[model samples]
Target: MNKRKIIDRTLLTDLAKDVGLNASHLEALGESCQWEIGVDGDMLERLVEIQHQFERLAVMGDDEYRGFYIEVPRPAPEEWGDAEELIASGEYDSREAFLADWLAFNPMETRWFHVASNRYGDSRSIRVTDRKHTHFIITNHSKCTDAEPDDTWCRENLTRLFDYLQRMIDVIVANPDGFNDYVAHNLPYQQRTGRIAQKEFNRIVPNCKIEVEDKETAIKALEDSVHGRSVPPLETMTIRQYCSYYRIANEAYEAYYRKRGASGRFYEDPQDVPEELRDVAYYKRIKFVDEEILYDIDSPEDFIRFATDHYGELGLSRLNIFASNKRQKGWMIIVSNSYSANVGLAIEVATALYKARAPLLIYDAEKLLRILLEEDYVRLVPDSYHNYMGYQEEGSVYELPWEYECSEDTDSVLNKEQYQAIISNAEWQPEEQAKPIA
Candidate 1:
């Protein structure tokens, strides 16, 4: 039997990291893309209506088109029990009679109707349903043109729709923990394993409506096994506790591996590995496990040699360079991502601002851009304070891009006078402006 390897969640996270995109954002993008390709269940119905309208216009004002005319019909509201009784009692034998009675007391616009045709020398008809009740222009039409709708227009509309959906998905993914808590108990029996934990189980199944009143009893029955007080000496506790213990054991194993220093790189033979850390295909399975990165490189002597050869002095220099250019000066503060020194590029760029004498005010660039600017030796301050604590009051301190979070901090700074000057002196040059994407 061929055993399929499961990639753990860590590996997936690592893959996301490697691609420089968040999983939530990726999911949003994927959904949006799928929607663009017409994964919607109702899309075919919509397309059918559109095509039917074209068919209805083919042959008009002919005797054969008598029953093909559009008819507006309405059904009684569900709240009308009396109407339901009459409808069941056959008080109104035909649809028209029922509709006439329906319209007498409660009048409403009919949004859907059918346009059919029998002039094709055979019976041909179409039923059109309006998805949106937009105002329709009734007019005479020539033959149905075979030309398709504009591709660019369709693409633009689809793109806009997808983008809106993606934004909503991003917001949802960012707060997974909160959403999970809301669905914990009411989930169905079949979907119990769908969630990461009980809290998450409750969240996604919020409307499942299953009662879970005696949760404590189940927990107590499994408690003896969880705390290792069960009767079976060899059997151990319940599955949930077993999972908890497995998590703890993995943590301990990782801690142990990390404590062994660079020498520990040689501990795991390339051919042999702990079961938990064996898989490399999964991000969770291989991340920080050390064995994957340093596996098979031979003894400590060989491992040390490899490290020195590949990442020793140059790596140290890179680390030093990263550390030195990391911190960015906010108007009244300094900030840096302590774990990763990705701001080195920004420091270099910020240095240019300093050289240009673009004011000591913070340039609201991204961390990297700020670091690049700082390489130019620009002095920026946090808006909250004056002077780097020297207590000098500056008039109307502007927030720089460094302080503001943006995927790319490229927004240029302009004083009130400068902005006014541009507005006053600017000329209309439509030709020079780039046309927006449709």
Candidate 2:
């Protein structure tokens, strides 16, 4: 057997530099020692030389590599005919028809053109007008065999060709403490890094309750529940199943509030509540109490008394306490000129009365004034104080007939003279004719 020539130390130093290794260490091992080293001892040295050869192949000129490689021949320039020529030759009827036929024959070549055009510059205007000719040009210029193509060779060798040099450099540069770990991880066929030991791997990737083969079925069931497509049976509960149940329950809570109007109060014990009625039941209980109190009041006096006792001072400003006679019904509300009416209180009281099965006929002070003026139910009294405060005196104020009453009583009646006098002198004008209410 012909013995392999011993690599000189100078050449070894240059190889070390090319592969990003410390050249000083190779240089320290002089020419005499390089020849003395045994075959087994010089295994790393031989690997460095192979790495250098691969690097040389990677950086070879494109034209030089293409000349050496056998490629598929290109079509003649005349083969790329325009739309008119294609139609005249009976190859295609229209530009679209020709393009479809060409694309079908050279799909890979069209893709390569897009990839190359995109990599080099703007490719928005570039299009496959002649796919057969384009395919031939791309294949003929490619520095790879007809079976492989340039992209295929680049994809295979781009990372792999540098892997040996990178691994060598990693070992040489690694800290002394982590040298063994570096070798086990960076060397061939050792891609997985974490939990190398079988025991550790088993601990991290625990077996599920369902078999591995049945995981897909279980996942689909869980997804169905999450998306509200279908609810899985409660008996077959898993982690994913429980998550779906929680989501469904939470959605039911939101829908309940949306349907019955938000009360701003969430259920106190969500865990104890049933999934279907978790949101509605809590609000229903609260509303039932409010309805019971409001329904028991048979007259406006009772309503005023209830508001006074339960809400005290804070409710007094909100309440426009009114009373209607037992017959010829007409409401007499006590209002203050100083206090501005609360719109929210009117809405809340109206909602409660509606829930108590009462007909809604309530109006604010401004609406009451408008109805009186429009209907001519009462005339203003010129002799009386035009801006009399409603809360100041019992009956020294504006007046209207039984039609203005929002209650069941019908015993009250106002004389025509009093009604006309009140309407004529009262300063409670329509908004367009009056200043802002004080």
Per-candidate TM equals: 0.16, 0.15
Please, what are the lDDT tens digits per residue for candidate 2 over residues 322-427? 2222222332212212222232233333233223322123333343322222221222221222333243322122223322322334443444443343333433
What is the Å distance of residue 83 in model 2 from its true position?
91
What is the per-residue lDDT of model 1 for residues 1-438, given as tens digits with 9 covering 90 to 100?
Answer: 212223233432333333333322222322332222331224334433333433322233463332111212222343223655676798866555765765664443221222222334422332221211111211112122422223454434323323332332232234323322322322111111111222222232232112222333323322322343322221212222222222332332334335435233222322454544433212223223343354443333333333322121111212111111113221111111211221232232223222322222222233222222222111212132222212221111122222112232235343344333322332211111111112
User: How does model 1 fare in lDDT?
Assistant: 0.28
- lDDT of each candidate versus the true structure: 0.28, 0.28
Relative to the true structure, candidate 2 has a C-alpha RMSD (angstroms) of 37.9
The weakest ten consecutive residues by lDDT in model 2 span: 110-119
Q: Candidate 1, after superposition: displacement of residue 254 in Å? A: 16
Runs with alpha carbons beyond 4 Å of true place in candidate 2: 1-317, 320-341, 344-438
